[model samples]
Target: MARRYRYPFNGKRFIGNKNSMEVHDLDNETKNCQIDEIKDEHVVTFIPDTLEEAHKQGFDNGAYCIGNSRR
Candidate 1:
């Protein structure tokens, strides 16, 4: 049997060498344990008197919200 060569960019085949493949398996138990650390990372709410105040506080960037609820 002849070996095959695979080019990442081009799908064309150029015979002779085989590409090495690597497989990574994540440990679910370890991942679950790490996820628990972030369970308490809740969003903080800020009460700004004005929109400008909110912007000054870095909360008006739309990435953060100023409300009584955490979303």
Candidate 2:
């Protein structure tokens, strides 16, 4: 099934939760990422559609989805 995004702001490859401030790879998200678990109010779509942009907004790489090794 195709995944449906809430904001889909810039159609970026990454998705993040405002509540947790964690960003995940939309194409490679794992079950642990819990993209579906995030509330609609917490869902965030980056404007620039880049990891750096997300980071600039205080979002961090998802430990489960975006690789834990990289901070």
Candidate 3:
């Protein structure tokens, strides 16, 4: 059987095969974002915060692992 999943954001639920999560600053600045696949996978789509932060967080080229494994 295919896996099913739901992501909750601001008290709302989004259903889909792919989940795009984003974090924006108070002034509407995009901080970091990621796209999660339904098969328990995720990829970094955007990390406009900074390259230092991205490197500190161990993300390469704005793409990396999701749960525990590297993508």
Candidate 4:
């Protein structure tokens, strides 16, 4: 089967922080998300790019960015 997504998951709409284990929605800017606080080292710019994957890896949606949406 063909790949559903491309490489470098960072290009996706959501980004994850390994250190904090929180997922941020790039398209939705929220203060609680604190996207600016993500350090280079903690940034997960590869796999687990989508919220579903992130959550499976024990990541939670940003309180402000993604809100309570589970998608």
Candidate 5:
């Protein structure tokens, strides 16, 4: 068996070496967990492209909404 990684462009991959780690797409079991983790951060919406950038944007948007909600 072989662990295939995404191409070196806009793809993300799991971290591991040969005979050590298994590199595969996010499984269904862990998908919910990941979603839960992000949801815990109060991220109402996020882009599916990049977590770091999109999450930051979501956080910022959340903050803005919170700050202006009373108005």
Candidate 6:
């Protein structure tokens, strides 16, 4: 399974995926999912020139993950 990370900010939750570059949008997958604290920091790389771009990517990743929880 592809490891997924959640970045919660500004009263919204954002999802990050290694396979899909950039941050996606907040989705049910993240909003309703349980938070599993990881001792090892999950590294999420955002290549976007601005924070907005990264947030957008995270939102997409989250929305997409809801359909594929098997990941």
- How do the predictions measure up, each by TM-score? 0.20, 0.78, 0.22, 0.67, 0.18, 0.25
Local accuracy by lDDT, each model: 0.23, 0.74, 0.28, 0.66, 0.25, 0.39
Residue-level error in angstroms, candidate 4, position 37: 1.8
- Residue pairs that clash (backbone atoms under 3 angstroms), model 2: none
Ranking by lDDT: 2, 4, 6, 3, 5, 1
Best by lDDT: 2
- Cα-lDDT of candidate 5: 0.25
Which is superior by lDDT, 3 or 4?
A: 4
- Return the clash pairs for model 4, or none: none
Runs of candidate 3 with Cα error greater than 4 angstroms are 1-48, 62-71
- Residue-level lDDT tens digits of model 3 in 1-71: 11113422222122111233322121221223222222344422223444344444554332222223234
Sorting all predicted structures by TM-score, with the top scorer first, yields: 2, 4, 6, 3, 1, 5
Best by TM-score: 2
Kindly list the per-residue Cα lDDT of model 5 for residues 1-71, writing each as its tens digit. 12223322113322111221112222212432232233222322223433344334432212211122211
Q: 2 or 6: which has the higher lDDT?
A: 2
Error of 2 at 15 (Å): 1.3
**Residue 43 CA displacement from its true place in model 4, Å:** 0.5
Residue pairs in collision within model 5: none
As a TM-score, model 6 comes out at 0.25
| Model 6 lDDT at residue 68 | 32
lDDT of 2: 0.74
Model 4 poorest ten-residue lDDT run: 1-10
User: Which regions of candidate 4 fall more than 4 Å away from where they truly are?
Assistant: 1-10, 46-48, 69-71
